[model samples]
Target: MKVLIVDDELNIREGLKKMITAFCPYVSEIGDTYGVQSGLEAIKKEQPDLVLLDVELEDGTGMDLLSSLDVIDFQLVFITAHNKYAIDAFKFSAIEFLLKPIDTDNLMHALDKAKKQIGNENLAEQLQILKQSLNAIRANDKKIVLKDINSIYFVKVSDIVRCESDGQYTQFHLSDSQKILISKSLKEYEKLLEPYGFIRPHHSHLINRHKIVRFDKTNGGTLLMETNCRIPVSHRKRAHILQVLDNQQ
Candidate 1:
């Protein structure tokens, strides 16, 4: 794995290089840059497999750096300092991120994730989705990018009726009788969609509050979605589901 460290801080760049070289044996070549301009140049020349990128640079933010690139061929792991909103955007987009004062464990974990996702054909599309998600976060939009093996679907958050877990896959049931099964965990979508009024009524199901046609609490609770799907509600989440629906009404 060829890696690049891009940050304005000299100490941070050096510290990350030292830790990565010591702990991450998969990394073959290591490159360093101190700011956005140099980082862009280094990326053009080195074409590193993964980049440990700081959120803020001397010249511009990481988002600026991303915007300058026409096509992102390498994987990115964002380095930020306790920005919850930005982190949520990353999570919603399924992008990797590392918190500042980076722990060895977290860094290694992010590296491992990057290694798996890097070199895949879907990366460019996924990065586009990442960019869109960031833009959506800034604009307070309720759209989500859902991808399958050969296609990417940009769907409104409100149009989703429910998400059902199929092991590592989550099947998205849409309002228009369309179902998209994505290669992501239901828990991941649950966390990502929580702010958009999606609730996990069962361990296997995350339902949209706006899509529920009726709530049947008898016989351990079930929600009848607008899609005509009856999703079971767990005992633990039954009251919470009802409360969410009530609040919406």
Candidate 2:
């Protein structure tokens, strides 16, 4: 596979090239470019299969370069500095990214994932979600990209009624009765969704506060979800959950 590295810093570009050469056996040719304008030119000329794109450029941001292109046929892996908002956007979009001063293990993992999703038609959709999340003023306006083994789902945060932990996987119960099982841990999502009013009432369940129909005190404490499913509120969290519910009232 042909690859392109686009970054303004010469050292970053060179370091990435050396790593790719040493580790990525499938990469046949590698090209390098600086800034958005040159990066666009290189992409058009080289027609690379994969691109390691930096978020910021001298001329413009990487998103600007992508917007200029009518078609995105190449797999993408974004490189960004330690910016929380940008990281959150990437996470929401389910796109692969490597932090500044990249780690070899992380780079290898990102490349492997990019290689697996080479021909995925959902790239554009994922980029759109990323852009939207970055631009959105309200957290509820942001959409999350969830990928199961068979399908990718772009779901609104408000539509999620609850998430149930299943070993290493998390099952999302949506308001429209659609369920999506993602290959990620509930603990990972707990950190992402908690700011949006999702409460971890039990070790195995994360509940959306707005989606709770009622709090049933029977058999200890339980939450009646909007989907008519009953979720247990653990003894440890029962007091905190009740306090939150009371405050909401």
Candidate 3:
């Protein structure tokens, strides 16, 4: 394991470094930063396995630094004089906080907890939350894949015209008349993509609301795609699908 120590005072940082090395044999590397500004840079560069961070810094607040971080994949130990910010740290099950003038016993306990919590959660959830919190969204990013011609093509959920079952293979239609065949069931992708703005108009079709140009409300409703791809609505799911589209409009 690699560790990064973030404290404004050199004395505090050095002392903490020795204590951690002496107690924890698993730590393979240690990086030190004197202030939150430098600490932020260190976090991005080093990407430590664990972070022992100070709440107060010479230039900025530790909590502010934490907020600015894309996501703390490491074990975060907030060492601060203030007790008020402890509430915020509690939200992440892995975070451990220690007061100033850290005690050996308290530090050991926090280390034990950090060891138990580190590297457990999957990376996807953290990445999504970090991207959302930073408010940096990539519009062209593809969140789903279409396995076609022995290669998986990553397609954005927004660009999808609709999905249709062609016997054993699934056909994905895009705005550019781009179609990909996946040797899987639509029901599988429905369970995966439907939660993210996809509506199932039929047992054989799944349409993206953002790409729907128009539709007929009559029985055997017709879905007119912006690119002139019209798909039939199945009687089984027609009511529920139109209701969902109505809710979106």
Per-model TM-score versus the true fold: 0.54, 0.56, 0.45
Instruction: Specify the highest-TM-score model's number.
Output: 2
Highest lDDT: give the candidate number: 2
Stretches of candidate 3 exceeding 4 Å from the true structure: 83-94, 120-249
What would the per-residue lDDT of candidate 1 be over residues 1-249, giving only the tens digit for each residue?
999999998888888999999999999999999788988999999999998888889999887887799888898898888457778867866778888888999999999999998876776655665665564454344678999999999998877888999999999988898989999999999888885667888899988776788988799988888877899988898788877777454
Query: Model 1 — which ten-residue stretch has the worst lDDT?
Result: 132-141
The 0-to-1 C-alpha lDDT of every candidate, in the order given, reads: 0.83, 0.90, 0.73
How many clashes would you count in candidate 1? 0
Model 3 worst lDDT window (10 residues): 130-139
Positional deviation of residue 111's Cα in model 1 after best superposition, in angstroms: 0.8
- Kindly report which residue pairs in candidate 3 clash with one another: none
After superposition, candidate 1 runs with Cα above 4 Å error: 139-249
TM-score-based ranking: 2, 1, 3
lDDT of 3 at 222: 79
